[model samples]
Target chain A: MAANNEFVGGKVMTTLYQHGTLALLVPGLFTGTQTVGELLKHGDTGIGTLEGLDGELIIMDGIVYQVNAMGQVRVVNADETVPFANVHKAHPQPKIAVEDASSDALKQIALKELKTENLFAAIRVDGEFSQMHTRAVLPQTKPYPTLAATAEGQHEFNATNIKGTIIGYFSPVIYAGAVAAGFHLHFLSEDHVMGGHILDFDLAKGNLQIETFDNFNLHLPVHDPDFLETKINAKQAMRDIAKAEN
Target chain B: MAANNEFVGGKVMTTLYQHGTLALLVPGLFTGTQTVGELLKHGDTGIGTLEGLDGELIIMDGIVYQVNAMGQVRVVNADETVPFANVHKAHPQPKIAVEDASSDALKQIALKELKTENLFAAIRVDGEFSQMHTRAVLPQTKPYPTLAATAEGQHEFNATNIKGTIIGYFSPVIYAGAVAAGFHLHFLSEDHVMGGHILDFDLAKGNLQIETFDNFNLHLPVHDPDFLETKINAKQAMRDIAKAEN
Candidate 1:
């Protein structure tokens, strides 16, 4: 039953939080028969099955948890012996603690991890023949004005400014006969210092060209050559992963 | 066909966007048969019908527009004239007006907009409920330092620190035999000084909760009383409109 929905099976990409905690979406792991606690104890190595709403079993990391009709995550694998450990236990609880942090703090931490992992480039399919790409980087200085004591002892500061460039690519995929086959790509080259976590993206840029196919063109920035290389590498990795899983 | 979907048959909501603009999904809008150009021409007074993927025909103004499998828009009303007043026109060619402007200039503009718009408050959804509920205020002093002196100063200046407060609610609709019929709600209250758009909202909060229901209770940031009132008012207006149409 789980094999029917071939598109539903995929590895959960892990993202780290400011406190050094991890979070990832485990697709097709909700079977409604076990709690998140139970699933965590089952370990991550074995293939677990979840019963989908359509009555199909979804193969996942051998663990089952329940998610309500709404897409919010209810339970997580909370086993005691799991590797990397859930650092959320000591505070007001993992979810609450992380959720309560400043967005800037969280973003900084997340981006730092992504840079360390070299997963900073983002790519999306725009149409059959095009792809959009961008990167995140850390600014050497802040964008806002600093507060300084005046002669009379008054202090003042102002907002910071930041900019990100979105570069697009026209690929050979457009000639594949599909009405639309393109991708949107982004790279987090600038570090977002506020969130404490590096920016992680969930993409939907690949399907954009179906509506704007006629307006296809490449807009190269001054850093285009290097950015293009990163885009190509990212796209290749994505294709390889898709092929391997299929 | 349009009359069947409306109460007395002539009123319908129309969304307008300029051609070439991205037709962003607005949750309730039926994506079928709605095109960017067509929506712009829908006009302040015109009759048209829109059909969703579910085959449910939503009266556009007074007539129905047939939607194709590709989500293209086709006008069905021969007599209704769609005005061109609100149509958004895109530049026929890319214009590089700021070829020499540093990235820092752009960043500063972005930050100014964010500050004026009070985006920081809107992004801080995880803070305490009271803090979240309070309207966003532009700080008299800038929080971060400036990068305007650096080569990438403009780029850094545009990155902003915006915050939002996510609020949840459950409202009872009607009392039934053994169950109480009600809907769950989530919303976000945004305060920005630029446009004076202080949204006291319930629908926004309700919508957020619905989308994030799984992790609702665990996330912090309490709901605002005033904003909740506004949301309730909005919900009532929607209910009235829905009822009148039926």
Candidate 2:
């Protein structure tokens, strides 16, 4: 199995490609510099947000989709820019049936099934959801406020008896500032009518697929003065991220 | 200046390629899987150690050199394995001159000159040192001890009026567990006769060259059981790293 993919010492080495830090996003460094076109070059599946906290983004099957504050889903333009994202090449992994599980239960399942508690893993869940609760922030103009502030004004969307896919990445506690520690997930309904940053969900029945990542390619925004000039306090930023993301 | 290298929004982005995490090292996970030949494919210059924490490694001008526990420097073979390393392609950058400066003084100059307090940067210093203090650990067998314990048995070497180069990296506080926060440097004499992990140094005169990195490619060893099964405690590992490296 290791020899099937890119191998290093006969071990499959899958990379989780990340753009911009969650710490940068907490302080509202929302200027989009990397285009959706450029991001696809690295990997095909992931999640993130557009510039100015425009919407919740889902990259599936090499296509970019955005779920806006008004609960409208649209196929994002190739030239559209993204402020932050986590993408990776998808591969076949063992699957497990998850029934009547909450968000926390899903995390526990990941920990037990994947054995990636200390390492990074990319997770995907596909099936029917009894309840899905999500939110998306309205696009902001120049001089954006902190993400926590933006999240407070975010619009919530709820759906019941819906079929969709959940995409997210699991980061270890040590990488809290660079990426959100633990499961950070986003949802996209099957019909492309409902999707956003997932706040909570009750999985009625879903097949959980997970791939462990051995490499992390962290790309920073060095050109943006806002990124370089801002004094990012890791501890404070982690707190802000927890508030906003949760 | 940004246009001279790979540009994203008019900013030059150089990358630092790292194999294995410092946290893995503190716990004494010292099985070398990545070969030196394979590592050089990512960058030309860097610092790290051989398998089993055998010695201090200094990579310069695309050559891999290892300073043994007895302070003997020798060119490493292409197939020699590396347990941990940090490497990047050398690029031209503005230079600064330092005379009569300590290790702390060198760090201050880097912070002032590079303006990379929140970002990662690669630093190099070449010149004569009035005094140099360094150490290297002997090779360990199976069931290696913790790095802090190994540091106790490390062989320390000191020299005066020597010409050498300092190679190191500056990682932000947020990345303390992944990489050591602040400056982590290693020394190699101009004659390639005396070099090791730097404990302290007094520079008589040296020209400093610094390059800011916008990307960090961290590769982990997935096949090694020590890497996969070990439960790494970030906080404890950090304390141990400080004791060993300092």
Candidate 3:
């Protein structure tokens, strides 16, 4: 779904929310044909943004929903366009678990599994989270500010007793702009009532599912006239992604 | 200008080929509006394939050309579509020059200047070469085979007394599917008589111009039905790219 989403080429598959390379949804450039229904055909799980970055998109178990600007999560229109997303079929590993672990500590365990930075991986954290902090960017209009600027206006949320799965991608630093250099994740409650890119969390009891992808395939938005004409500055974008995603 | 050719924030800049994520040219996908002229707007140098995999696309000093399957070089039509290309503005580093240098030795020098592999870089080696070997992929059509399969039919060339620039990119391992994990170079003779994706070469003497990209931006071809439907196997594609480009 994003950079390092591949392992030289392997059997595991993973998708991501818009990688930094394809991040920053261009305003007025929506109306895409890649819908949730279409995306589901490719993978059963992933994250992305609705057309115009209208809200956060969370695709889990083939169903799609949007976390609107009001922090309300609801099933989305199947025909709605998805300008950017990262997803993959779910493949949970039952061997890893933690009853009480901070997000930072859990990430260390995941890193141990990584072994090397070159591989692309998908992570799933399921169970109850005693505490979690998340954020989502409100959609923008034409002349959209850089993703970093939009991130500055992110809506923050704090939740407790949240039962859901945290989904994300682990990219290498080399892919900084192509995708997030490191982990880029989003959240979805079991009830589909809460979701957005995750910032921090504490799991009272959670199990981790890790799937590694050896190879990656990325399809870009070429037909969009604005995408064709834009003069992109990647350095700043990487900075913005880091500031916002982390 | 592909995915990394971003207008998103008009700020994020990145350089990746249609290298190895959204690298390959899919079948039944053509009539791209992102022309050689359009690519030139972003940078003056790069390497890619023309629409329908017509030929090798080499853009040097702002002019784009195709090295056909027959090994004949000619200026490409500005309107010609480029399905996949890797390009960036020229950055001539006079201090990085070597006389009577083999391509292998020269690469070491460039690596030293790199200092870090985290950034995307465009490398230009301009000078005389005692011997050079290059190859190009013929344009393709609908029901296109995987790039690895297409590589089996690649056309190769060997040359001496060649002078001009070798244009290409250096991506990190994590971006293997998105860009070449290492050096991916293309040759364009100063006389505009020959060029192709690099295979091997002996540079009698050459000057190295390495431009570091702080960020990367890319656009995926989403409208292509195949892009949306195909189950990408990045592992095999990377292998194929290695077989063809290296």
Candidate 4:
């Protein structure tokens, strides 16, 4: 019974998408377009990828899955193409609790329930998982090397008591190397057949949802003639996207 | 004709807005409402204020000035009321000149043309200011005395050889105790009669414009039943809003 005037004059319409920048996908510049049916006609949830880089994406509630490349997950056709994403549209709040921590101690208890670390949070933890280590990447074409050489070789998965729901984001270490500098999660399994992204887990309890993003809008592809004629070499592409998107 | 397919699929539908959180406007929750004529519907530009903490706002291009507290500057009034702000919406890019610089060297040359700093940018420059330093507060009620003690009195103003267009925002330092962590400007000269907020300026050349937001939406007033039952005491309200909203 408390959402505080649900954002009176402080405004809060929530809409996020960074698209391309890790200094332009580590200089590889992988193309993009097939926008996920216009981000599911106004988001319902998020996580991203697809479009040639074929694989790993999760959009819960509004349906839109795709894990591909051997590790197989599925759901996405009608020609889904979105290259990178980070959707949002669930403004519900109030749902806390859980047990075992881990995953950097749930990012220091969601950084003390996000007092500050430079805002941007959308963590959802739904339950059941004594173990979980996911990964999913495999799809790149036309000379694309960075993204730590296309995430070197990802295809790891482990699940124990699984039900699932991680879908996350914290983003702030000045966007470390461009994204995932602070936190980034992605997982799905409510029988939608396993998931990807997330790299660690434990969560003893379940049902945790946190949302905090305070106004930010950045959309740039500059009509892409190589997105401003690529040249990005920012310190070895922020050290290969801080060791492959952290 | 190179908008680079405007983010083809990399997706970039930015929209940032973190309305309330300096631990709930430092215990003094100065009531809010008029929502800046509804954030000028799709934003024309920004910088915030108005509710109780009367004066000093700047909406530029989409119109909405203020600056009260003695310094008097007018314009806003479509039922204005906003409490805090940070608008955007103008993806036209390509305008650079800026000279003499200062203001953290134009934020380190706009952080190297903003490659990344955890996204959120709208900096416009325009130009022709030989000098400028502004402020403008003076409007609070309900025993409110935080905000670095009502910004310990503010009303400074200075201008000379001016034309105008400062409306700024950079935000990222975990929203410096909830907003205005990194950069936050607000000047409007050009015939709209001097403005406020910006605390310094010297631009030499003109035309600077830069936009980037990548999504972020945080609007929480929760129907202000004391806004989620106020309780924020986070290190003296984040050292009094990181020393008065950065």
Top candidate when judged by DockQ against the true structure: 2
Interface RMSD of 3: 14.2
Tens digits of per-residue lDDT for model 4 on B1-246?
111112524664555554555555666676773377666764677777877778778876678888787887888876767756766666678987878887678878887897656456778888887888888878888777667777778778888778888878886543344565678788878887778888777786687877876544444444456654555554577677767655
Cα lDDT of model 1 overall? 0.19
For model 4 chain A, the run of ten residues with the poorest summed lDDT: A1-10
Better of 2 and 3 by lDDT: 2
Would you estimate the TM-scores of all the predictions? 0.16, 0.92, 0.54, 0.34
Query: Which model is ahead, 1 or 4, in terms of DockQ?
Result: 4
Q: Candidate 1's chain A scores what TM-score?
A: 0.18
Top lDDT model: 2
What's the residue-level lDDT of B50 in candidate 2?
93
User: How does model 2 score on DockQ?
Assistant: 0.39
Model 1 residue B58 CA deviation (Å) reads 14
Q: Model 2: which residue pairs collide? A: none
lDDT by residue (tens digit), candidate 1, B106-150: 223333323321001111111212211111111111222211111
What are the lDDT scores of the predictions, listed in order? 0.19, 0.86, 0.66, 0.68
Instruction: Name the runs in model 4 displaced over 4 angstroms.
Output: A1-46, A50-53, A58-66, A69-82, A85-193, A196-246, B1-46, B50-53, B58-66, B69-82, B85-193, B196-246
**What does candidate 3's lDDT look like per residue over A92-112, in tens digits?**
566686888888888888878
Question: Best by TM-score, which number?
Answer: 2
Off by over 4 Å in 2: A1-12, B1-13
Ranking by TM-score: 2, 3, 4, 1
